[model samples]
Target: MKTLLLLLFLLLLPIKTYSAVIEKIEIIGLKWTKEKFVRRELLFKEGDNFSKEKLKNSIRNLLNTHLFYKITPEVKEKDGKVTVVLKTKERFPIVPIPKFRAKTNRAFKTGIEIRDYNFRGMGNHIFLGLTKWFKNEHSERNFYINSMFYRIIKDRIDVGITLNFFNSYNNVFTKDNKVLGNYDLKSFKANVYMIEYLDLEKIRRLMLSFRPEINKYSNWIESTNQYYLSLGFTVDKTTDMVYYTEGSFYSFYIDFAEPNLSTVFTGSLIGTYSNSLKRGNINTLSFGGSVGTKIGYSGNGFLLDSGIPGYVSDKVKGKRFFNFKIFYRLALINKTVFIKPTIAGGDAFSNIPDNFLISPGFEVEAFWARLVDGIIRFKIFKGIGSGSDVQTSLKLGFRW
Candidate 1:
């Protein structure tokens, strides 16, 4: 009986545990966002093991949303347990934006856009925009509505919808830089897209989209209806979403359209890389190219635009093109203001001038969370081949 009692006592001895368990989680500085939304983005939960890597990734995920201007994490240990604390400063979510641009010997365009980054305290985004172009008595107008919704699931699926209407009286140019004629175009379109997070490390997404559109042209042009389908993929590893200072981004997409029951195909690829230098300076480089071709009786094509600084999109019309750009920015005024000088050039081939184009430009941008964000830019571009001309452009925009 004594031996049996001693064996039972030895078996009942307490075992020691070494892993630190989370005791509590504290979140501070929330003005418009819900606590659950912030907690949903976290990688660690109560009673989970304390992991520094998970905490760092949680902070990065929160910052990528652009919902906070500052985020800090703190850990406290007591009685063999740990407490995690998060401190955040929220950004102003609503913005009323105005934009204006003009080019040498080209029509001036002006527009206004309103965006709500945080709609109804959720992570949804909504935007309404209008644009107008003035060229003598010929004017053009465009209106659009865009919205995005995110599901609160583990995979975090996102859906977006867009509506657009446009009416334009455009002047056409010839190969020798002469005005060919003016035509009136009217169009309306509706688009729906869904993005699925592929449960990959650090933000990889896939998108599927469908669009239906109708267009009418004046002066004995045929009116038509079209349907489009698209597939897209993106890999974003950027450290800072608002002001990208490091990491890389890559995206590729292909689109198919049935215009008047004829099949057309288009595809594009784009990439960007950014790095932060010492003393608060940043450098960024980007390059992109697109190809569009018609099959059989398809009439749709691709056009290059001033989408790239110093290059005019309307100046080139082609079935395929490529472009490259380099930008370096100097930090000034507490890192909130930046002076960026850039150089970009590209050429269009197949149905357009096969000449190389070069453009050099500079930009001034100021970003402040307290007041407003604004930018002023100027660029000068020269074409090196046929149908090329030296052009200058100015642009201004404000958001708050």
Candidate 2:
């Protein structure tokens, strides 16, 4: 009986094995196009025994490119083998040039600046800023003042105040508006930084200074907003004020201020850029421009005074400035210094705003101590079209 059963089992085993042989497999549905991005080839060889595990792996590899928004793989079998097909949707990659953002050491300690990423990823491009400075060498010698804020919605706010300082007045006006200006108890300022976002792929930002220097005028009572645009980095308030646009990979700005009753006509453009090279050296370029009238008073109006003589006065009577800069950010003994050669068109101004007038100068930022930074700059300005010339002036300041 045992021998008869063994013979039957052998006969049945051969029949079952033959039934398991795959005849054909079909694969279909691919997600990516043949152009632009190349797809990986199928790993399974023709006429080979199909393994489900091997087919599944091939589908997974294709999806890892991150270029696909969706991926689906299907397999079909006929007679003896199985075929696999992948259906995929390709995704476009959007590259973002990140901004190396920073804030004052005091801001970090006070927790005044709060955010996760320095470079916001919501819109195609955006810019935001907040800065405040205060100096209290001793209780007897107290000087407090310096603050500005620029944002692109849901970004940040900056406020500043000073107790002892030079006295300055702000005059306000508008189209069909009356002239009004005022002197602050000490020229203290406080403002909200609002940033506007556009659908453009390039960075856009605006900062407003609502210091109530023009108390008599209604428009001056509320702060006015200024715009700045750029492709990458920015550092310094003056650049944002005068030359708002220039440079290839740095900061850029555009300002639109009104004259009387919201009659916005005054505008300015500026930009700046810098690069780091081998041997602890750096290269930088900065330039900016604007075209407008030197009307009555307003924020930053002191700058618009072209200082040009007259019609043939060898000077344009509006605000105009241009600057070319090459600088290096160097490190020595655990400290850094930014040294640059600068050529400016309107460094203090002559009679006419022209290419003829040129000021050649150099600026230095020395980091002597970990907490002490010093800045000194000098320029020799010569007038163009005319022979008017001015002596070089030196600026000295300390930063903590």
Candidate 3:
């Protein structure tokens, strides 16, 4: 029958000409070294067109350039012309030192903390801390101070300053409703940060903050001062989430604050989502949310006069308030070493133009922050609350 139908059309024409010869090859430019590849032009040329998903996306864009430490992509085909090669391995960057530990009987108790991170890479960081607190009931002792500063311009400006005293006694509204006394909370903060890198890993961060606060409630009341200014924005995205597990992250942030004594000016929104799953050792699931609003213009009053007892000092003029929150996080040794547990809740509603009031609460946390290899961290924070103003706290600190 006509030579077996021409042998099935010559066997489907070589599988449709090898799937159309894979149109265009990929892997254009990627670099790091030789002076950031000629000041970031990243070397890769020639009328490019070779496929295999563009050589695995140029080997994930040269290992996301954290200064690379091994990344190789090689492909060569003769007679038809196709050659793409990129091999890089280099790493040496360090700035890590700031460690901490803490305890309290009503205030201050800390051990092992040394801060200094040798800078000069167009980025600088500094920290100095010393603490000890407990003034009565036999443990008699009091001395405190802490500081921090960070500056950078490599990827676009970031400046900061942080100072805290006595660390706010684990801060639950800075102590009042009968909490064993010996209170002191002083804070000064200034921050400006902006970062953009929407490719090769993705990132965007923006922040502007100013905080000045003072609260002293020692023998039980009257010692308050407050001022706050804030603006923030953040968006982060990362991919590659399958087996080796070192990816999958998402974040969102929004904030606005203006408080010189409370008549309301705090709008906030925060969100975070994380995912990771692996059997022989990796697991993570995180989700978080927050919403808050308190809008009023003048009538400044009620900024901590030993609050929480029949709250409503009346100068809240055009009043309005609202809050909402949700949280879930569980990560156990998720790669290096990590353990986080959080369950949160929130409810606060108050209005005057048409009267409304609601207050609800619940929060719990078990924390751990680390990186001792770099020099410090083993942080801790414990919190608990069921409802109707019953709060608790325990915190240990360290950050670098």
Candidate 2: stretches off by over 4 Å: 1-144, 147-191, 195-211, 215-323, 326-339, 346-355, 376-387, 398-400
lDDT of each: 0.68, 0.36, 0.39
Report the number of the highest-TM-score candidate: 1
Model 1 poorest 10 in a row by lDDT: 270-279
Q: Model 1: runs farther than 4 Å from truth? A: 1-18, 99-111, 131-139, 152-155, 168-185, 200-202, 241-244, 261-300, 303-317, 351-354, 370-400
Residue-wise C-alpha lDDT for candidate 1, range 264-355, written one tens digit per residue: 34433333333333233344443334334333342434332324344445545444555666667666565566666667666655556457
Highest lDDT: give the candidate number.
1
- Residue 390, model 3: lDDT of 32
Whole-model alpha-carbon lDDT for candidate 2: 0.36
Which has the higher lDDT value, candidate number 2 or candidate number 3?
3
Each prediction's RMSD to truth: 6.5, 19.7, 20.0
Q: Give the TM-score of candidate 1.
A: 0.77
Q: After superposition, how far is residue 330 of candidate 1 from its true place, in Å?
A: 1.2
TM-score versus the correct structure, for each prediction: 0.77, 0.35, 0.25
TM-score of 3: 0.25
